[model samples]
Target: SGSRAVTIDTTPPGAPVITSVMDNMGTVTGDIANGGRTDDTTPTLNGTAEANSIVRVYNGTTLLGSVQASGTGAWSYTPTA
Candidate 1:
């Protein structure tokens, strides 16, 4: 009989931080901060996560989209709807 060893990764990635949310599709194109508003339907989201990891964006439990983080742990996404 032969025995085999298996390895598993249990470490979790760092928490993602949303740096900015920009509205580039509307007349007021800029970062929406401090409880600001925008007419743009598809605002761009910029953030950082674990390097080379998958970042998922959600809105009230509904997933908008997913984007892979860069080698530097940076990621961005813009939803179509």
Candidate 2:
């Protein structure tokens, strides 16, 4: 199957307030990469984007998974690798 281009309004959906992001080392920053290599293979990723929007977690170009933001703009994605 081929892919079709779906256009989405690139306008601001309001400033998404990412409150917290916790890992095995406790809370970390949001909207930025803030970790080095760790022994933990599975880590819980949490954040807040535009509510009801989809949040995709990625390592470089590799997409880990996607999580739907809650009604309160809260989202979490736990990686298997």
Q: Which tens-of-lDDT digit does each residue in 19-77 have in candidate 1? A: 89999885788899957888999899899999998999888999888999999999999
lDDT of 2 at 41: 59
Q: Write out the backbone clash pairs for model 1.
A: none
lDDT of 2 by residue, 6-64 (tens): 99998977644444444464355223346444444566767778879888777899998
> Which ten contiguous residues of candidate 2 have the minimum total lDDT?
25-34
- Model 2: lDDT of residue 64: 82
Model 1 scores a C-alpha lDDT of: 0.90
Best by lDDT: 1
lDDT at 24, model 2: 66
Evaluate all candidate structures by whole-model CA lDDT and list the values in order: 0.90, 0.68
